[model samples]
Target: MRQDRKSLAWSTLLEIDSQPEGPLHRKLCGALRSAVVAGRVTPGSALPPSRVLAEDLGCSRWVITEAYAQLIAEGYLEARSGSATRVRATAAVPNQGQPRSNPQISVPVEFEMLPGMPDLRTFPRKRWADAVREVTASIASADLGYPDVFGHPRLRERLAAYLVRGRGAAVSADDVIVCDGTLDGVVRLCRALRSAGHTHVAVEDPGWSRLSSAVSTVGLTPVPVEVDRDGLRIDRLRANTLTRAVIVAPAHQFPTGTVLTPARRAELLHWAREVDGLVMEDDYDAEFRYDRRPIGTVQGMDSARVVLMGSLSKTLSPALRIGWVVAPPRWAEALREAAVAVTPPPVIDQLAFAAFLDAGWYDGHIRASRLRYRSRRDLLLKEMASTLPDLEISGAAAGFHLLLHLNDCDAAQAVRRAARLGLRLVDLDQYRMSARTGPPALVLGYGNLSDASVPEAVRRLAEAVRGKGTGTSCG
Candidate 1:
């Protein structure tokens, strides 16, 4: 009889209609919360295990696990050792709040050259699947329980070693705090810094626009520092005494791919030391350098003053939403506390990643991706040389994207012209931190472009430039 009641309660969840747009786990959570409030599932009644409930609901176990974890965090559910999870006694239905507005604006895209994307076509599905299977089969019971708010212990240890050897980050497992992605890490870091009395944070001008948004969201001002030929200007940073924390993509500056010269790197550290400030390094796309070996990260120079953040978005799939922050001893606790205040990422995914890194599959995947990106970059440069000689290309040293300087030509007009010609591209103006004007430049991403399509795309862009009175020909 109790079994029937349990089935009926689970069936009510299945009947709950969720919006098709947002995450299914969120909808499941809503359904479960409503059931608890409506007195259908009384307090002290046991809920089915995540695996069994998922099977009955025709969903993934992780989905069910995540929903349960969220409810547990909200005080709607409670789990006891060696016992089933139970509905907690509560008079108030926790406010789930309204869903956030979707930011995606639908637009026509033909030849996609937008930056900050990796080749999704070549994702190593077989290896990832095998790793997931191995992890699930052998995972300890303790892992299936609530995960450490900091991170999965084994994954943290594995990531520490990997970052040290691969990226030259001086870190230990204790210092690593896993996050959903680089943006998530930064948001949490911003809040922690704000709590510690940082009012203004410095960002690179003509930088990733999302950085500014994140900073502002945490009630901190994002001061735009200029990026010169070498990298971020230390002179500007020094002048801005109010700004104590700065975010940098030192390995490869976004939009414009310039490395932070050794001298500037030293200056940045010195500035941080003098000001008793912090440097948040976004090591995005540092693994795929073409011409030479990649440079060491800024965090290796002075780990105490620098916090290193990185993710597999470039190396693997961004959809995975896995990243980590290795902070200094002083800042690690605050960052971890901030991370714990939010929903922790799934434990199973973290364990699978640990297994993947432990087996060296991550290294192999990076090598394969590097080769493909290098070939595409070479083909792009070759095509541009023959078809569009007037445009100056820069940032070819590392990363998947390159910058094309369109001197005097209106970048916005050229972009529209390219779109009309069935090619999609973005200009540097879109990445500016302020309304301040600078020379027009276009950021062309070759990560997803095919070898056969490179020449045609360049030709169309050249025509767009020629239309602006450049009079350059695609010879």
Candidate 2:
């Protein structure tokens, strides 16, 4: 009986009640709270009646009531005079979310060079607190009815202005849809495309792997298209007759950091026009270009053909969980309908974000983070040159991460050695679907390290690569 109850709770909270030296009431409360938070019991989902749950757990009725009361006090459960107890709506885990294969599973966290994570330690907590307080006090009570089915109007207006000025996107408040993050935005668009009869979509060959779930979750096939020096291969894109859409990380392609060349951008526009297939452009980190001025966004070339995804996750913090999709006129309604079907982020958080952007606090925070991260990137590059010279580098133009190719070396073995040394690093070959792989490369991220620890981290990595100095080059 306890095992059955434990299984049910795991489906909701991913945590089982610990075997404790406590009374039955405490254990029962822990199990139920864990179950609700794990999403086993969704918002508005009701709980078993107190008596029914008591009978199932083989506990007294009063014991179950007290347990339910504890959950209610903790804000994880709710109760009414006659209605069954229900789960309260609350954020369960941390870091916006992960690939989300199991919404119930706790987000996976280990070496985390999986890509695009911001240095969250640098989040402007003081500024955020001020903004949150201001919004919480100022927002009218009636605004809490439900999320603006289309997203917060104030955020839309602010995001449109920011995108046009900063990212070169063509959008109006009406054209923007707020979402949890890029992956959520993708899920929304993919669902809309499916509704419109789009079955197969193209994704870049060593693209964001999360797309496997985000795109397929909505029942569309993610067709793999190769990306080379120019960007997404136009030849293959043009050749595919069945392609109905495409997803591209054009700003600084994930893991590789290659910006899309101008010619390719034009070619992409031409293809979108000719094929009538929309391009969902993820223009992340366009604000932090170190070498060249960040190029104008692909969405600006033809707003009718491109859907733009931009987020505060890298610019601010992933914990903010605020992102927007600037859709073409055709996709606006479809995206909103899909969002309504799932959990839209809390209204209060959205309002706070809108206020933050409106007050110009968002821009101030971005500029500070950009300067700090740029310094980290430059130091990491210098350290790599001084400490590990044989490594070939690419995708270093922008973003928090850059890839270093170990010349003709055993990438897998090097990664294992680095792991053994407590130095975390990610391999690039795993990003590819085909067996034809790139050189032995490590995707190193720098934004999280303190100034003093940068060199020490590189020093340890160097030792790992040498295998204590056998120094065999992979070339």
Candidate 3:
């Protein structure tokens, strides 16, 4: 078998060697070099012994040895005292110029305050490792095969129960479809909706751009319905007659951080029922409410007309890549069918998460995260008030971020100025589509910001807002 494989591996070399213009040894060296450079002989693959190769090629052993010596000098092959000659592990096509370095597009800032980011430092590493070890030890061999396209049965069941108890979502394990993350869930649902003949998806005006972009990527137009202090305007949704679908973060909307009022929630459901539309609810970051109980999911109001989507991105770490869609029975089969072409989250991870939920570690983590984030939010609010007394802040009741309404300063200008002073900021307009008449504001996230850094962050932000540049470097 090895001889057969080597014969196939040397086919390219044989092709190169058939041309006989140079010394036999030189030709052999050139052929070997070409094979290695073109990856016909992969790195770390053992080359046949010189005698065997020479006999196969009908060449003198002296010719083979000289060729091997030449190629080894070229840094393409290596030989040990008693082992077969092999391709060097680092051998590759030689670069013609200076090697390129990866772009630093996402390097974290000294004060990274990106909205929707969880406090990664607070991730329960020990508990998660315990869950992983337990799952790996006991997972049935049958469970390691091609996973259920929708999700692991155990994770789906645990998620369904957790959603019901915590977010008041109306769901069952059969209704759950696990995905890579919330955006992934949105993409899958959008495909299912498109398959079901839907064309337009009504999204919040200043909503999460990633989700809206996902809708458009799957060939559906994202209609930007205006959101006010009361959450999505049902009247705006009703005016858009062409849309039979909508996506919302009703529990705690991103950027704006407004909860859908009971009245609007009811109206939105009524509109969905009237138009036979489907509501894709993004339940991102609904786990942290500082002042009151987190609002119940809109799906609980009318499960048939709403599909709830959530993930561990905001609750735990986005690195986990675990998310789920709780679809109503009407759309469950369509979602499952749409998921057929996509790979679900790893079964091991799914099982570990299930064990985490079962062990109550997830709940304990959430409780601890909520308290920590609430404290950070309070500190940020207090510091901002003290430093920029005139700045009006809103959306502090829940979620990982709050909006700082700039009455006099330009939000875009402030973001640029803040960057120079080592403060990372996101303007409210980044989330806006057609509607841009709101007051200039910055969306400040305190989730990843340390409590000790809050005072300094606020100080830098104040300098930026005031158009004052302090020469102090960001440490």
Candidate with the greatest TM-score versus the true structure? 1
lDDT of 1: 0.80
Candidate 2 lDDT over 1-475, as tens digits, reads 0123323543234233463657777777776766555555566566665566667666687566656555554456544322345565442524235445552233223333335678877787887888889888988888768767667788788888988887777789889888777877877787689889999888887766556435543456777788886678878887779896999988888767778888888888888888788999998778878776777789998999999997777888877677888888889867766664445567788888888878888888877877787888888789889998877778846778888777777777776666665666777886675443776777777766666777877887777666776556343
What tens digits encode model 3's per-residue C-alpha lDDT throughout 347-385? 999999999999999999999998998888888888888
Question: Candidate 3, which segments miss by more than 4 Å at Cα?
Answer: 1-108, 436-438, 469-475
TM-score of each: 0.77, 0.76, 0.76
lDDT of 1 by residue, 1-475 (tens): 1234355547555445853455778878778887777666767777887778888888887567556655664557754433566776542533344234311113345588888789888888988899889989999998898878788889999999999999998999999998887877887788889889999999998788667655654556789888888999999999988998999989999978888999999999999999999999999788988888877899999999999999988889888878999999889988766664565578888988998998899999889888889988988899888877777889846789988888787888787777767778888987776554578888999887877788888888788766645454222
Better of 1 and 3 by TM-score: 1
Clashes of each: 0, 9, 0
In candidate 1, list every pair of residues with a backbone clash: none
**Predicted structure 3: lDDT:** 0.80
* Residue 79 local lDDT, model 1: 46
Q: Give Cα distance to truth, residue 38, candidate 3, Å.
A: 21
**Cα lDDT listed for each candidate:** 0.80, 0.72, 0.80
Q: Report the Cα RMSD per candidate.
A: 13.1, 11.1, 16.0
Q: List the residue pairs that clash in candidate 2.
A: 12-38, 12-40, 13-38, 256-395, 407-474, 407-475, 408-474, 408-475, 409-474
